[model samples]
Target chain A: MSAQGETPVSRRLSKIKHIVIICSGKGGVGKSSVSVQVALSLYASSPNARVGILDVDLTGPSIPRMLGLDGHPVHQSTDGWVPVYADGGEARLACMSVAFLLKRKDDSVIWRGPKKNAMIRQFLSDVRWGELDYLIIDTPPGTSDEHISLIEHLSPVHSRLSGIVVTTPQAVALLDAMKCVSFTRTVSLPLLGVIENMSGYACPCCGEISNVFSTGGGESMAKRGSIPFLGTLPIDTELVTLLDAAAETEQEDDKPIEDVEHEGFRLLRRYKATSSAKLFGPIVENILSRLSGFTAQ
Target chain B: MIAIQQPLDVPANAPDHCPGTESDLAGKVDACEGCPNQDTCASGQAKSAAQDPTMIPMINERLAGVKRKILVLSGKGGVGKSTFTSQLGWALAADEDVQTGIMDIDICGPSIPTILGISNESIHSSSSGWSPIYVQPNLSAISIGFLLPSQASAVIWRGPKKNGIISQFLRDVDWGDLDWMLVDTPPGTSDEHLSVVRYLKDTVGVDGAVLITTPQEVALQDVRKEIDFCRKVGIPILGLVENMSGFVCPGCKTESQIFKPSTGGAKRLAEEVGIELLGTVPLDPRIGKSADYGVSFLDEYPDSPASQAYLDIIDRLRGILGDK
Candidate 1:
């Protein structure tokens, strides 16, 4: 209660608006990409807004890569955390992860729970996140130490959290998403909505929409739970390509050559221009409708 | 010396003030003595009493009213420890003779308050100390999760903090005497586990540690390490639960191992470690579904196979403890 370990630093950093967390039951559910798109959408919609993303997936942090922010140096200031700029200072976003701490890029995070919790608290306290529109968090799949600690650290402000449960269309994915959703309720956190990613796959050659993982599960879950159903996303090869290219071009101005296979570059460019309308419009609308008076953008 | 225990309701104005820093409150007992309610508020007295080593008056005063202290532990994560703990706690609480209290030492993964459907309970600290939220009529529970502000809030504490919390949970929460106190520890043999073992070893001997593991080779491999840790620490290994041993198809009632159905892991390890194999929990999707809704399968589907497994485990545990 004295906030001994938390210190005055965490006190200063606690003031922020709408901390939205992106979660998945299992890996490969595009949890990171969905988090990136949501943050980007929030950022683009409000130029004055400050949006930061914390990658809690120590071993597999993909936010920097998907946001095209790989290999960018993040330096700390006395006031708060300052994310190294990407695209030649075009965007200033605060990003921190165990991935950022490793001496080399490929080194694994071989830490236990207490150590993991310390780093998470450090990220919350030390980082000068500044007042922001949304602090998008990317959690590791399944309920692990990092995920549990993230919730514990944020519990004092559970009312402010809008948890977004992400999952693929598969039954196993839904099962995991339900566990994540239950975890939210267990911790007494508010249920924002559920996003079913990879709902359907559109084959590039055939231009047909096929239910690869079994569509409509996430929406049904949302309906059953009486929470908002934040629309579903189809499997687009172009989107995957856009993400890959974005990862490569995020930190630097590395332009992809025409001859090279970089679908991420082309798709993400188009995706960006109409992101508000295409990627996040329905989801945002659903969230706003459920929340009533609370609208981010 | 078995005595019937009555439920003690927490007073409306029982000490609602959160204990300040441990150092600040260390010598402030005389200041709190002026309050009308000193019995519960005087945990500082209980802490001093605990230092007596042989004076189990602290344990007797605290747990004399509580029936069983069922400690649930896991060798590692993803072994269905929380799920099993939730189910077992509900089953015991459902019995009239058995009042239940779950102390989740999985400070990092305190999922019980949500799993048992009490995540919204406001944890108020009274002049008496911290008040635990009641999940059932005779069942009360407490965890850092319940103490947290949100499900996403992380408890970042070191050794001293962890030790203080374990002691606070044991002494502060008003777990009125009656039935059982199920403790869900974080997976692995680490600081939290050591803290619990050390506390119980010094005070009341840990009744027993329920070791849960999945049938997977990876999970079983971790179980061996846990067994060795228990031996090193002199903590009693009660029994083994093979969770997700096989998934029972809801449609046909046919059981199959979704993650490798073989019981080689539990059987071989239990034999090697010389612990009883309690039972195998089927890979029932309903258990996972119930867990997601914060409902235990035992509460939702008492007649289900998963529920039965939990009941059998509890019965076996009762036999072990009662015999001793």
Candidate 2:
């Protein structure tokens, strides 16, 4: 590998190609879930591509719980703060958050802006993150200090960092997302697109899709602002169940959640596959290409 | 020489100069309780007392230098809050009659310096205060963008903290007497907008605020919400400007509304909110192109339809402010 600490554009910069921040303008849009899926999507396309997910939300860090990574202590060694590997033997995929280092996972991090920026900077510089194809930063709701600091600090290095803003199809969410788009554009960052999460919900008994957050808010906002519109995600209770079950399963067990033997796990995979193929695949490819400074055909 | 020799015997006895204790110093400070500079000295000492305690007085002192606070908000974002702010600032500066500055509170997505054609190297600070780069001869501007590391970084802020940051921007910046201060707020009636309005209402009164919107149903709906917010806060509505209302075809000079033409977005909303219609910006390619190229359309194409429309808006705003 090229010696570490090279400039972001240098050929020796390694596996890390771009940093994509997955955020929401308002809360309860499944921002973390979308972030996880985006990280996994990048990995699925290029399995060996190094990837890191930094949960800067501070308040609602769902990576540990969602990935079924629980009770894993973050390893601190001479190489810097090392993210706990889920599979242990397999290559590490993402970084563990400061949330995991706390005695209690649910405690609030009441840090001021400068210190928050300092912590986020530590997450970037102190972490022994190797060259990776992508670093996904999942941020909480609203435009405020932490988000500004993350974007400001990272922008100088990652010139091509694109944003995947998630919003529900509601007036409030769209309004906030619209501000988000303007905010992103103001700084001259390429708006990758808007993702409409919880676009619809399907009742298993009725076998019919129902508008959950009122569909088309994202598309309308995108159309109005002229931003690229990413595909929508339906609310699936089974996916939630599978995620919960995955967290409970032992990492090394033969019946691990990824094994697909679990019915809920199988259902989750099928849903992800269908959604990834139908909606997220193209969006991911487009963003990755854009950040890599390549035009899509 | 003879006069100096007379005091030599007493010169050997030096005055006692023992360092005072903390309590003794506190007593001395208490003794100056009613003095005008007492608070300044006390707070200055307190700031150095801790590794990084809240330096309340220093921060308050920084706030005293601000002048001419303006709030640039829209019922919606795509309607051109950022665009209007940049253009209005440019227009003010273009005219030798006024000096202008802008503070972008759109923390989620700051674009002030960018629209003003400023770069990372352009944003600088000095002993005087954080210096805003002059976009026009008399216009200086700052945004959360200037403080950012890059456009791609995520701005993840919450409500209360967002308020604190806005306050800091207002009170901390060394904005010397400005003819006008334009604040570009994030869309919606959220904490960002509320923070700016509240700060102006509670601490400093705003002269007036302009609302930007397009002729569209979705934008109109949010406009009503924003209007209600302003009313609740008692912030005076300066006027409403319709942006991107009708697109004029470059080939034929034929105007067409891309989202169905209706006066409802700005005009009707202005009437409903009991405010005057400032003006309408035609759907001009030059505006978009100028924003893309980081130059105000007025500067690039002085006679363009968009530029003319912006000039008209400025005229109306001047009338409202009695800038005869």
Candidate 3:
């Protein structure tokens, strides 16, 4: 915070059209996958919607791995830290993560709350987002520390800032996810909706939806709260393999083809074949429609 | 307002050879340089040593009856930390004579109450201290969720407040005589993890920590950090439990790779990190359903593959602990 009533974060983020955060109170509910797919969907919806993802889960940063940008480094410039573009130099999907700061992929970031908060504050204040249409913040599982810091810094963009709660069908996951919805309301951040991830497991051999984890927990929570249900996402083995495979191998050795590039989503070319991209494409379009209404208001 | 505080067992950011905060050389040692708690540990230790040196002794006295203390930890959230804790409690309590206690310190989202099937139970003050809700005659547990007015509400607390509540839980709870005590911690290596090790390390002493993770590079990546966190704080690593290892299709009985283990999952991770791979529990939908319903999946579906796997892991765990 500065004496002039504007933070460096707000000033740096001023160029972004809308910032939506993807959060779930529970971990392993696919927060990272959803964030990545959402970024791809937004960029795929329109070429002009430049996107950036800020991975804030300091202890367990999967965004770098999810986007196949694990070994990528964040370059510091005269303005601040320059985010690594998803592809080569000209791509639109920019990203900043603590994973880039580590020398090894498996290195641990062992810091207490105050230290984690300091890094988070620096992430918020120092990253140069350039001109992003949407900057989706990927948060860890909690309503403490990083979350409080994020809401504090982004308060200036509260109206343009929206929150999306992700959850699964299990009672335990939904039990905590319901609190996530209430948190957005309590903080006065506009609620985009609730997404039920891992709703069911589609068997690879049989091609049958197994109801493995059951379904509809997120929708019921959304219905009870009168919030829009963003639709359920089944456990996509296809999406899992696409991202997981890309994560295992080194990216950036392949030559770029002209024109059909999916900005920010390095793996979106194959991700489109996954059921997640197909399901998320329309969900994002719906969100953008509602977002347009929000901005218009 | 600063009376006296419990010094950290080993602050998270402490150097390799950093002495425990209770040490007279806590803030004075070379390893304590750049430790965030150096200032507080220095002045607080000096004040407590002068004014009241009984704090550690009192905490030690409070936790005296617990025979063994273990922490269930995972660096990533929602990786079945609470589920494993609850099931471990049930498995230990399966014996008619063994008494077990579970302490859930995941303040922001205390799902232990829900997972233990005690979501409706509330903590009560007893003559001795706070009475933990007994789910069974042998199994008892406590969580901040029990203190909440409703399960639907979020505990929007900051770190200091979380630490305060954790301290109070330790000081006020009468765990009584128990054969086993399992503390389920929230994900990440931060305030709660440090606080648990801080209060319990020098007092009753943590026997070890059971690391849990799904078979994925991302989850494995975090578990490695957890391994480091335990090593840094001097907590012995019991082993790692791989939950959601692979999903076995109920229809075809064919196991599918829900989370592809591109980096060889926890098996390779454990081998690489030089820790024991206790066991991998395959994904069973009934396990999640049971946890949500707050019942013992081990009891309901003992014949199932997941249950047997859990039993085998528990047997290995008992053997490992028994020899020690």
Candidate 4:
């Protein structure tokens, strides 16, 4: 094994106690939504606990829009690049994404592997994530350049790093999701467990849970693979409204979601009222329990 | 400050902190000492440099049998790229005389096999090249899923491995005499995108790309980037299709915007970008069910409005590519 010495990346990431990679081999399975909700849940669990979300889904970054931190930009400090906070500046949750550096938010990244790798390295080495209790890295949906870059940079922090695999409930999703589990196994990244996001649809009007995508496929995959199946997160339209309310209430009478001040509390507060948020509570507890096993040397 | 180039292409085996393959000092740099792709990089296989001009004619000759190819792309995932490819395969192959194929280049998530009802089929490569799994008498398909030892096994490959397979899929796959081929890509303009576009664009011309998006602004935002990617690469835009436009309750018969288009959705985006709005398919739960079952959604739900919309769009696409 390569010596796990203090490399530049590990030196920077050392302050972050727990590093969780939220990933899947499949796309459109609500990885971003899960990452945001998990961050919100962590912050809500302990408002003072510092959390950071590094959105490495470079070509298709959705974290800013989901968090309603659309117009915020990263600033260069003397020490390093300062991340934008999801809440206010003093808030515990910080975020760094390629989306923050875009000249125009909607411009196509159009970069290939080497460029993406350099950016990922810079993100790991340059972001000044001061003393985070937890830092969740949301990844793109492939096993290519970005994933490789992340694995290389985070290797030294292996003991502190694990992965939370997200998947929808359909067989096609499960088939692809199994590969993600396999990748984690190959890389020897500790498993935090699997999350079955988009498991079902929570109909707002009817107040019933429908198996729109399906249910329990994640559990079966987990059982077969012998990894922990954290839990199922239904398709909550209410939460969708919160994440995308910028568009929903864009032209309406009320102030748009992103424009409102005290942004973090409002969004996190409303997110707490969501069914997904309610379910994520136990999931976080499971994560916390698993992390507690690691001695903080 | 590290430079991020336009359409940068680097092999997966390149060493860490390696100057990009497109760099003038590519393989000559210190990092290249033991890299596997060092010699290739030094020889200028780097795409943007376009040093080896023979690559185009070679790929063109390899793909000469393919008449017209279309790529189904969305910068966002789970928006039904594979599902659309399956339906398009079935629709195009409806005429038995027409030889149609769907190339699943999503690599890590090759959902086409499962969606096309061939999840159990493994590929067979011969001296001629790899033989595609026949989905129908006329419709054939290829995917890394088929090449996997098991459907659940992960490829876990980086850019170089992906690029190599994509090159083989285009140059070596024996897709004999395909009339219409639909290339399904994963969400992003990364390795697979650059490789496929370069191979096809430099060779036989691509028909264009059919962009997919949901009604929400978040999804549409990515579609704009996908369009930009296409424009930058010089791939023509066929049109845009708004999927999951709305959901109709089986009981109330009322339409609801499940993924509401806050800023007019794809319709507004099409108008703003001066691209045609091919069609919009409302959210039908059965579409997911059909894809999960590995059956043709258009065939199973022919009477449904979504099916009708799909047929209409297929007709329009054929019309656009008909003269060729």
Predicted model with the maximum lDDT: 4
* Candidate number that wins on DockQ, 1 or 3: 3
Each prediction's whole-model lDDT (CA):
0.64, 0.62, 0.82, 0.82
Considering only chain B, report the TM-score of each candidate against the true chain B: 0.80, 0.78, 0.83, 0.83
Q: Give the per-residue lDDT digits (tens) of candidate 3, residues A117-194.
A: 789889878988888899999999978778877877677666678989999888888878877776776677778898
Q: Which stretches of candidate 2 lie over 4 Å from their true place?
A: A1-297, B1-68, B261-263
Report the first chain's TM-score for all candidates.
0.85, 0.84, 0.94, 0.92
Question: Once superposed on the true structure, which residue ranges of model 3 sit more than 4 Å away at CA?
Answer: A1-4, A248-253, A257-266, B1-54
Q: Looking at candidate 3, what is the lDDT of residue A140?
A: 91
Q: Which stretches of candidate 4 lie over 4 Å from their true place?
A: A246-264, B1-55
Per-residue lDDT of model 1, residues B85-185, tens digit only: 87887777777766778888875456677677787776777766667888768677788766665554434344445655777777666776656778887
Question: What is model 3's native contact fraction?
Answer: 0.70
- Candidate 2: DockQ? 0.07
lDDT of 1 at B124: 75
The DockQ figures for the candidates are 0.04, 0.07, 0.40, 0.36
Question: Which digits, one per residue and each the tens of the lDDT, describe model 3 over residues B1-324?
Answer: 000122334533467776766567778878778876678667764325322447577778888888988899998887889988999899999998899999999987888988889899888887798899999998999898888767777766567667766776777788888999999999988888888898888677888989999887778888988898898899999999999888888788888888788878998988887999999998898999998899999999989988998888888888889933
Candidate 1 error regions (>4 Å)? A1-297, B1-60, B125-129, B261-263, B294-296
Model 3: per-residue Cα lDDT at residue B265: 90
- Which candidate wins on TM-score? 3
Instruction: Give one digit per residue, the lDDT tens place, for model 1 in A1-297.
Output: 232345544464467767888876555566777887776666555446567788876544656655565556777576766654432343435566655565554333444567877888878777777676678898766665666677667655555677788877654456556667766765666767888886654434444555645678888878877867788887654555456456543434355434222332332355665423385776766664554444432
- Tens digits of per-residue lDDT for model 4 on A1-297? 243678878889888888989999898888898999888788777647899999999999988888877757899999899998866645588999998998887789988788999999999999999899999999999777788778877878877888899999898888889888887877778888999987766455664556767788999899999999899888776777678753222234255445664445566767777777878989999888888776443
The order of the candidates by DockQ, greatest first, is 3, 4, 2, 1
